[model samples]
Target: MTLYYDETGDTKLPFESLSIAETVIQGTLRYLESPYDAEVNLLLTMNNEIREINQEHRNIDKATDVLSFPAIDFEVPGDFSDVSTFDLNPETKELILGDIVISKEKVLSQGDEYGHSPLREYAFLIVHSVLHLVGYDHMEEDEKETMERIQKAIMEYLKISR
Candidate 1:
């Protein structure tokens, strides 16, 4: 799996953000039983940049902790049964999973607000965003419960705590 990460501005992450991102992504893929190698793009940005992206992409006009843009639209959430050859990257053959954009400012604040280390909160958000890349959503109760369960399992798999 390849995680393409780019950080904009200097929000100063509280931890080795790339390492944590890689570990959580790997754990998430394993927990979901995804057979194909994948590629995920991650962007770490500050409040102003995140707000612009949120407005441009989601029309929210506000900053958010994280935002996910999935490459594949699975017929069934977290099920790769429908993946086709065309979904693979031409050269590497890695599935184009999706992109995740996070606001570093929110990570620190949320961590303090929730009484956890910034590392834990950052890992949680990445896990949540990865779930979205794999077609998970929380718009409904059952979906929310299922996603929560999967997230908890992945967090445990990574041994990350809040």
Candidate 2:
């Protein structure tokens, strides 16, 4: 897996303690023993820029901790049973997963609220977004529970605990 990251935000604040944006591109190359080869891009932008994106895309004036844009449709493939395994890219050797957008301001605020470090919150957001990229959703109670369980497992695997 290849993870690509970009950050945009206020430089005045401590660089180590600011907002971040992470974009993950999954292809066929496996970095971890997971089913997908992924690339992650992280961007740290100012609160105003995040707010603009929120208003433009989500039409919500308030800032959010994370925003996810999934490239693939969630409808189970007809050959789902036949193809028990995921497909891989022959060229890139990856899965071409999707993208994830997050807000640093929200991370900081939520971290404080949850009594955890910002880094942990940020890792959680990334894990959550990656799960969404791979056809995970929490539209229902059961789905939410399942997704949360998966997220926790991934975080634990990565040693990112709260």
Candidate 3:
């Protein structure tokens, strides 16, 4: 898995030594057993910027912890059987999973509020967003249960706990 990472925010991350965000992302892909080599784009931004993006895209008018824009619409979550040739990157032949935007401010605040390290919160968010990229969603109760279960498993796999 390849991660294209970027950061755009005045608020720096609370934790200084957590490059494990990349590990969390790759771990998610492995946990799902993605059929093809995959790449993801990640952005670390501030709350206000994410809020504006959320408002523009989702029209929710609120700051979110993370947002995912998936490149493929799977017939079933994590089922890559139907992937097409078009989904692959021409140069690298890797599946373009999609993009993730995270709120750095939320990573700090939520970690403190939830009584966990920022690293843990950051890892959780990365896993959550990667699941979204693979077509997992929580719009319904059953789906929520499944997604949550998978998330827990991946977190355990990565040895990251709250």
> Which candidate tops lDDT?
1
Look at candidate 3 and tell me the lDDT of residue 28: 80
Candidate 3, residues 24-123: lDDT per residue as tens digits? 8777887888778888888899989999999999999999999999999887889888889999998888999899999999999999999999898999
Worst 10 contiguous positions by lDDT, candidate 3: 14-23
Q: Candidate order by lDDT, highest to lowest?
A: 1, 3, 2
Candidate 1 has its poorest 10 consecutive residues by lDDT at 8-17
Q: Write the per-residue lDDT of candidate 1 for residues 16-105, one digit (tens) a residue.
A: 999889888988888899998889999999999999999999899989999999999988998988999988999999999989999999
Q: List candidate 3 segments past 4 Å from native.
A: 16-18
Task: State in Å the error of residue 79, model 3.
Answer: 0.8
State each model's CA lDDT, in order.
0.92, 0.59, 0.87
| Cα lDDT of model 2 by residue, 1-162, tens digit | 545555677533223432232321221112123554444445556677777878998899977777776555545421122222244445666655555667778777888999988777877787777667657788999889988887776666666678
lDDT of 1 at 149: 95
Model 2 lDDT at residue 14? 29
Each model's TM-score, in the order given? 0.97, 0.72, 0.94
lDDT of 1 at 1: 87
Residue 60, model 2: Cα distance from true site in angstroms = 2.0
